[model samples]
Target: MILHAGVLGLLVGGTVIVALMLFGSLVGVRILRTWNPMSTSEEQLILERQTYLVSVLVAVALWIEIGSALLFIHTVDDLHELFVGAMCATGTLNANPVGWWVLAAKGAIVLLFPIWLAVNGLDQRSGSFPLVRLKYGLLLVLTPLAVADLSLQIAYFGGLQPDIITSCCGALFSESSDTVTGDLAAIPAVLAFPVFLAVSLLFLAAVGWARVSPRPISRIIAAVLSPVTLAVGVVAVISFVSVAYYELPTHHCPFDLFQSGSAFVGYPLMFSLVAAVVLAAMPGALLMVTQHPALRDVAAGSERRWLTGAAAAFTIFLVVAIWPLVFGNLAWESM
Candidate 1:
């Protein structure tokens, strides 16, 4: 399994990303120690050039990181057939539980990378490069995570064995099971559906308020609600939205959303949610830099765009999530 093309590709790509991150970290250290935007000395000149180079390198790596995250999911899902009783990516993950950690790490990297890029972008917009040190310090902080992502991927893929019989999603997602996922699965659609709808609407309203008013307090409210909405959205998917997708009241495996038979609707559904989360967080994230006069105008302009994007994303999420329930043959009484 480790020799699989997708597996090898991810490993190679991850290796390259880690190497770039390591190099960036070294540059980051130098930047932290000696960055002086106002100085016109040759050393400062060299540092300026290096900062641009490192930024581009890191940006490319982060973009790859996003692609790698999606590929990781596709690869794991593709590998499910090798394990007995395996039906989806969940089974591949069950084959080596560490794969779950790999998934999580990839998710974190994907979420953080865009935020970092946003910060770097805002800094570049300023003549002083005011965020140079902060960006590099963040780079240093992120290097370990990149290293851990690669390491965990190695551990996961290397540990997979054809002989390992994994439990299918049905076993884990069933209400009769004791796991947290089971608890989510157990949540009655009657209850879960309403909760999901309400939370999503509230999130939309908050984001709308921010977009219309463009106040710090409003943006903060939208930002704070964003993650909460994501959490509830996941739970809603597990609880009822997935059932609608599968069209079977008892079949609650969220991983099945990526399967071909479902037209891979999960990809867009998930992308919408993730995009919403990232965009929603940006206004508040910009808040951190807005305290500096140089960033205030930039942040102000960016916040409006962010809030608008976030509102659109959340709306798309709601529409996709409820599509099955509203149009499909699935029914609450089926449960």
Candidate 2:
């Protein structure tokens, strides 16, 4: 595993991120303890520069981390050509459970990074805003996870044996198998599709209503529904996207969807869902924003963009996920 190009990339990227984040944690500790935007001291000025500088570095590091995750998957899938028994990424990942675990950890970290950026934005634009320490504290908390994710990546790559006979996607995803994959496959498409659509509509309604009314009541409604929307989004991926990609109700192997033959369509659908959720949830998150002059004006514009982008992405997901079912049904009728 260490010998593979993909594994090397992942290890190198993860190592850099850990180092940067560790440095960030130290800077964050200082910032949290003595962050004073108004003070004209040399230390305050240096701290401000350090904050912005580290933020940029962390942003790049996070992007690299995300790319490393995708690369890891692509690498695993590519190995199928070399392994006689492996047919898809599922087989490669199944060779070592830690492979996907590290991927998942990277994903979680990437998602949370945006929120930290948003919080940092609030603090930067508003000198007196109270979230500085909290944001720094979050950096500290995330550092350990970054370290662990890298360790897991290293362990996974070190342990994976290339020639081992592995259970391919068929066995792993077969509905007859008594596993979580099978349970997800068992979800009735008729019921799941409707539920997914309903949740999406509800999420849209909440965001739109909040935007129009701009009241605490409406904001609260959106905030409460955001998590529900994310949950339904997951169900939709499991029940709808997986089924459509494989064109088989009994096969729900997500990693297999990334195979070259599939044109990697799963990438957009999955990432779009994530983008939509994060963007849709931003307005609700902004409710906690302090009433600072710089933030007040800019926030409105940011919220508008988040709303527009979220709505667009959601629409894309709905269309892409439904196209297969609709066309397949039509072809069935023709047959």
TM-scores, each model vs. reference:
0.97, 0.90
Clashing pairs in 1: none
Best by lDDT: 1
* Candidate 2, run of 10 with poorest lDDT: 326-335
lDDT of each: 0.87, 0.74
Q: Which residue runs of candidate 2 sit more than 4 Å off their true CA positions?
A: 82-84, 127-130, 290-294, 329-335
Tell me, by TM-score, which candidate is best: 1
Model 1 alpha-carbon drift over 4 Å, by segment = none
The C-alpha local distance difference test score for the whole of candidate 2 amounts to 0.74
120 in model 1: Cα distance from truth in Å? 0.4
lDDT of 2 by residue, 156-220 (tens): 77887767777787887676779887666667667777788888898888778766665666667
Per-residue CA lDDT of candidate 1, range 62-164, in tens?
Answer: 8889889888888889999899989999999999999999988988888888778888888888767888877887888788999999999999999999999
Task: Give the TM-score (vs. native) of candidate 2.
Answer: 0.90
User: lDDT of model 1 at residue 171?
Assistant: 94
